[model samples]
Target: MRLRYLLLTLGIVVLGLLSRKTSICSIDFVRMYVGDVLWAMMVYFGCRLLFVSLKKSASFGVALSFSYLIEVSQLYHAPWIDSIRATTLGGLVLGFGFLWSDIACYTVGVTLGFWVDSLPGWGRK
Candidate 1:
């Protein structure tokens, strides 16, 4: 079960990275939004991996909070944090700016996570 969540998280990370490539996705809207969606999905799966005993709702709550927090954190632009955001990994994880659409994407992603987590064989412990 833990392995499943870990693999799902990693797979989502790959997809999120691929979403940024114009050649791979082709669609402008998809390229713009899919990364944020997959980012939230990865967060949910990561939460599930770390808190294996948590109920689906609890896991969703944690993931949603974390995703939103990260998004909100973009509003703060201190030199130290900006320098971190200048790095490749930091740019990917922290992002450059805040978008209202990203919040919607996150909601969809976390809700999708909840739906997936409720599936019988897919989510069963």
Candidate 2:
């Protein structure tokens, strides 16, 4: 269980990084959406691993809420926050702007996480 979620989280993070670094095959749409979606997925996986007793629905809800909090945080732009956003890691995590589209992406990602967790043997102890 732990190994499965760990690999999934690593894979999603790698894909998210590739989405930002590579512009392959008209995948710019993916470049736009993948980050936020996989961010939620990664969070879901991490949450599941950490809180092993939690239900999938609960984990998904927590991940979605965290994603929304980060998205909403974009509305604030203090100099310190802006400085943090200027860094690649911070920018990727905190984001620079808010978009309604990102909310949809997060929902989709968390839903995917929920579905994936529902698979046989996935959430089993």
Candidate 3:
């Protein structure tokens, strides 16, 4: 189960990276929104991987809260944090700006994660 989540998180990361490429996802809307959606999904899977015993509801809540926190953190700008955001990883994890749409995307992603987790057989130990 942990391995499944690890692979799913890695796959989502790759897809999120690919979503940034114009050649792969030419639509500006998709390029912008899909990455955020995938980011949330990755967060959900990461929670599952780290906390295998967490209930689906708890996992969803934690993932959603963490995603929102990361998005909200973007509103703060300081040289120390900005320098961190300047790096490739920091840019990806912290993001550059806030968007209400990203919040909506996160809701969708976390909801989808919950739905996926609820599927039969997937929940069994």
Candidate topping lDDT:
3
Clashes of 3: 0
TM-score of each: 0.95, 0.91, 0.96
Q: After superposition, how far is residue 99 of candidate 1 from its true place, in Å?
A: 0.9
- Give Cα-based local distance difference scores for all models: 0.90, 0.86, 0.91
Q: What is the C-alpha lDDT profile of model 3 across 23-113, one tens digit per residue?
A: 8888999897988898999999999999888888999999999999999999999999999999999999999999999999999998887
Comparing 2 and 3 on TM-score, the stronger one: 3
Range of the 10 consecutive residues with the lowest summed lDDT in candidate 2: 19-28
lDDT measured at residue 31 in model 3 versus the true structure, 0 to 100: 94
Tens-digit per-residue lDDT, 1-125, candidate 2: 88988999999998888877664535778878888788888988988888888877788888999989999999999999999999988998999998999999999998888888888876653
Q: What is the per-residue lDDT of model 1 for residues 1-125, given as tens digits with 9 covering 90 to 100?
A: 88899899999999999999988889998898888888999999999999978888899999999989999999999999999999999999999899889889999999998888788888844
Error of 1 at 116 (Å): 0.9
Name model 3 segments beyond 4 Å from true. none
Ordered list by TM-score, greatest first? 3, 1, 2
User: How many residue pairs clash in each candidate at the backbone level?
Assistant: 0, 0, 0
Query: Of the pair 2 and 3, which is ahead by lDDT?
Result: 3
